[model samples]
Target: MMTLSNLTSPFPIFHFIGIPGLEAVHVWISIPFCCLYAIALSGNSMILFVIITEQSLHEPMYYFLSMLSATDLGLIISTMSTTLVVLWFNLREISLDGCIVQMFFLHGFTVIETGILVAMAFDRYVAICDPLRYNTILTNARILQIIFVILLRMIVLLVPTLLLLKRLSFCKTNILSHSYCYHPDVLKLACSDTKPNSFWGLTGLILTSGIDIPCIIISYIMIIRSVLSIASRTEQHKAFSTCVSHIAAVAIFYIPLVSLSLVHRFGQSSPKLVQTMMANIYLILPPVLNPVIYSLKTKQLRGALLKLLLSKNLPMSS
Candidate 1:
């Protein structure tokens, strides 16, 4: 007697592809990956530590930056956990539950980061366009509320998507592109009706990026209007300089994301390596570069970092 479980292995295990065709050089690939992960972990951790310890860094702007760093850390840990294991050790098999867990965190963190960036854009809008009301508007209580709402939004949209996934039986090929468990990658392997899963996935994406991208754009437009209204060029430059880091952050985060989506949607014939590497970039680049960007671009963070580093060395030198 043949059973469905016997044929498909209910809760089928999935396998990972290490760079598609370049399987032999996963060792070389992991070298830079390990380096990037090290920098991302240490850098974001340092940013959070500095922000927490230094009383001067407790303002609303730095608080938002701390949230960004924390999101980046979650993203890095979620995706990189499987990546390094596959690249360095050649272990590629993952249980269905494990893959689903990875998918949840990866998608959740990505959405959270977008929300945090939008929040930061609003933070800048308040700082520049309504300077007098900045602190009053972005109070500690309000910031906590904002964070809670974002997490709630993530849960509200994502939980049903995962639940829909659980109801589907994955009986197709269990190979996934990239080293991580991506939503679309997992969805296609389901051998059951997936319209509900797809709809929820799209709903989650639209609610996050569809709304967020516009809010960020509108916030900056207002910011630009306020900056140009200033009489002195120096003041205008000063105001614009404050926004450079944020603009850079937005660009780095969005560009790779858009590219990866386009590749998946339109470039179906493209090499798996292209899609795989793009996914890697979308996950890894922001974490590795955001700390460097903030540390170098934000004057107060830079000074605090230098002071902390110098203080540590001073005692050691003696």
Candidate 2:
């Protein structure tokens, strides 16, 4: 018989509970979760495929959309396997290194997505606010440079958090609250002091998501001012219309994120099911909704998608 000590030895394996206090209904719950995952995967994949294949989409804005799709794909991949395993097979055991890897990718992809949103905001800002200089400012080389900088920033900031986590000794229950391994959720399982881990984690959050949100807001503020300054109601409508898809994407991504944070901080007495649901929404909604929003709102993407699909269905000439 395996002893309790053997199960939770220093840096021992960790298990994830799909949703605390809701194991009895995990199968039923997984039905929706699996559907959402499929949607996220298919939608983001279609966006990437269309953007890459359509030469007409070789613009800075579309490039940013590609990056957004890539980031969402990464985010979904980071958690999908582990989450599905837990839900489908109840295989919750995760080694320490595996957990760390999951935490890194999950948080890193999230930060990258946030950075991409900020970049997209800047793309919109330039397109709307400084249309004359848009092409000159967002040259292909410059966009590539911006993506490199965003990725480097995320990696540098996340390393410290991972290092701190690795240093902490886990001697407690070794069970994670959610299906996925998050830095904070993992940190809570450590028996040793996690102040450094917590401090660095919070700092990382501030540096990435925190900074990105304000910069995005500032970009939109400038965009709104520029749009309003246009004398024609028609031009103003056009400008605002261009921003609608981005605004919707931002809202879906941030609202659940903020709600999850609030629930974690203030809803301690709230049911675990509520907290888990919010977290799932935060993880799943944006990836599933963003491409749909873009496809519906952006005429260029819709037209390209229709053309692509129609071409595939048409008979090939010999």
Candidate 1 least-lDDT 10 residues: 2-11
Which stretches of candidate 2 lie above 4 Å from their native place? Answer: 1-8
Note the Cα lDDT for every prediction shown: 0.91, 0.87
| Top of the candidates by TM-score | 1
The lDDT, on a scale of 0 to 1, for candidate 2 is: 0.87
User: Which residue runs does candidate 1 get wrong by more than 4 Å?
Assistant: 1-7, 316-318
Rate residue 294 of model 1 by lDDT: 96
Candidate of highest lDDT: 1
Note the residue pairs that clash in candidate 1: none
